[model samples]
Target: MAIVGGGPAGATLARLLAKDYKVLVIDKRRLDSDPQKGQFTKCCGGLIAPDAQKMLAKMGLALPQNVLVSPQIFAVRTIDINNKLERFYQRFYFNMDREKFDRWLISLLPDEVDLRCGSQFKHFEQEEDAVRIVLTQNNKTHIEHAKILVGADGAHSLVRKQLGIRGLVPREYISVQAKFTAKEIMPYFTAIFDKEITDYYSWIIPKEQHLLLGTALKPRENVSSKFELLQEKMKRYGIKLNKQVEKEGAFILRPMRVRQLSVGQSPIALIGEAGGWISPSSAEGLSYAFRSASYLAQAIKSDFKNYHKHYLDNITPLRRNIRLKNLKAPFMYNSQMRKWVMLSGLQSMQIDEN
Candidate 1:
């Protein structure tokens, strides 16, 4: 089996399949002796809900205590256009060091899984029984023949493009994430919502010795300016911009068709954001990525006819509900729809709105 993109999805899948099949995981980034070097510029603010934690624990992985940014987040605050704030108490939440977490996850993979980093994919040619892949690594080009090919290459997936799968219709939403190391503040996860301004929210996640502060907005809007606006908002909320750590941006795809995970092409599958498993509302990819990886692993193991439904089951409902709610937001604005959304998330996730 050939797995492209050795991030969370590819690493997890490679680990799972290595038990039964020979798996090769390839990635473009150089694999340094230092695990932290594998950490790419991820847009996630590193907030993993309890359910996701449970899944990771099942995989014999636990969030390293030292990397734990925040454990007990009991409050969630949402700020509106007029600077009106509604705060709720969250029951549970976890803030983590994304780089550390990813490295930790990748470390769990078995040595039998041929993990190749700094390998660039050239293209692929389909044969009778397998697909022939052309890749370049260490300044040398090579060919990899696999019975199955899995694309976990993320949003701009080269595998998806090579397979002639149309990209998901670009949505109007985009997220800009910035990580900062500063003194902890407020001891909770907070999201400030202002529709009139950005049509999205600002987040403050307090971590160990630092805080992950970010803002997500519609893609059509000027994101650079929006980041400045978010910084000002953070200042208003009493968050001091002390030290800059890292900054990254991502585009969010809404409720759109995922052409990657089709069963039409036998022995080929797509997983993670490359498969369009991101939540349309929150753009949360970790949970969905985990879910998709597990499902795909199972389908590959079992006698499954339609894997698309299994993959869609993890995200379609949430995506549909979010789209419907967004459509009604114009009418529901005065009814505290934004506040309700935040509260509902806290309730469903069993986390306090801080």
Candidate 2:
């Protein structure tokens, strides 16, 4: 079997099925030895939410101390820009370095699995009994054959596109994040709902010594202008973003419908964001990635020939979770509804004013 991504989903699948099947995992990033050498990092909040923590615990995995960053979050400061409302919500999240976290997961992979770093998946072709995949590395091309192919390559999955399936359309956004040095560490994550900047949302995450400001903006729009405006808004909120250390961006897919999710067909399968399993409300994907990979592993272990059927059946709860999130999205995105909720102080942390 071959997996085209080395993120959480692919890594988990490879690790689980390595002993049984000859698994091969390919990733474009150099995550093996010196991951920092490339200076490439995924644009993410690097937050391990409660659900994701539960998933890790279920897998019998313990997060190493080195993978964790300082200022463990205990609450979320949600700011509604238009309504001029601010509230703190009790939520626990583990803040860590995304690259380091991924590296740690990759390190856990058994020697039985063949891991390839800095290798780009060109494409794949499914024949009678096996699937042939083309990979490029250092301007060289190579082909490999596998009985099963999985695409856990995330939102912009070329493998999913190659399947020629016009899956349900999900709302897409261009996510841009800037890392800035922080004078003082923040104890909580900040969630911004500023319709002026994005109908989606913006966020401020603290990573030890640096603070990350990111927002999801519509594609083909003036993203730079919107991001600048967001920064200005932050300044007005008494939060001044200092000198930017780095900037990154990526495509974000928010699935609003359960039908958007897919585990793929027989020979070809998908997982994680590639299969549209991300949370529509919070855009949380780690839990979905881990859970999907686990289900896929179970299916392969039970009956490899009926992997897709078993996977689809196993992920019914995940799909139902998506539906529940969809039901809650309006209470978040709708300004009037959100305003009422904030005013009601429902589940909001109370801070006494002296």
- Candidate 2 lDDT over 273-342, as tens digits, reads 9988899889899999999999999999999898889998898999999999999898999999999999
Error of 2 at 236 (Å): 1.5
**Local error of candidate 2 at residue 206 (angstroms):** 0.9
Candidate 1 lDDT over residue span 90-140, tens digit each: 446677777666666677788888888778888888898788999998899
Whole-model lDDT per candidate:
0.67, 0.90
Clash totals for all models, in order? 15, 0
Top lDDT hit: 2
Show where candidate 2 strays beyond 4 Å: 352-354
Candidate 1 Cα misplacement greater than 4 A, ranges = 30-32, 35-39, 57-60, 70-72, 167-173, 256-264, 304-336, 339-354
Task: Give candidate 2's whole-model lDDT.
Answer: 0.90
The alpha-carbon lDDT assigned to residue 192 of candidate 2 equals 98
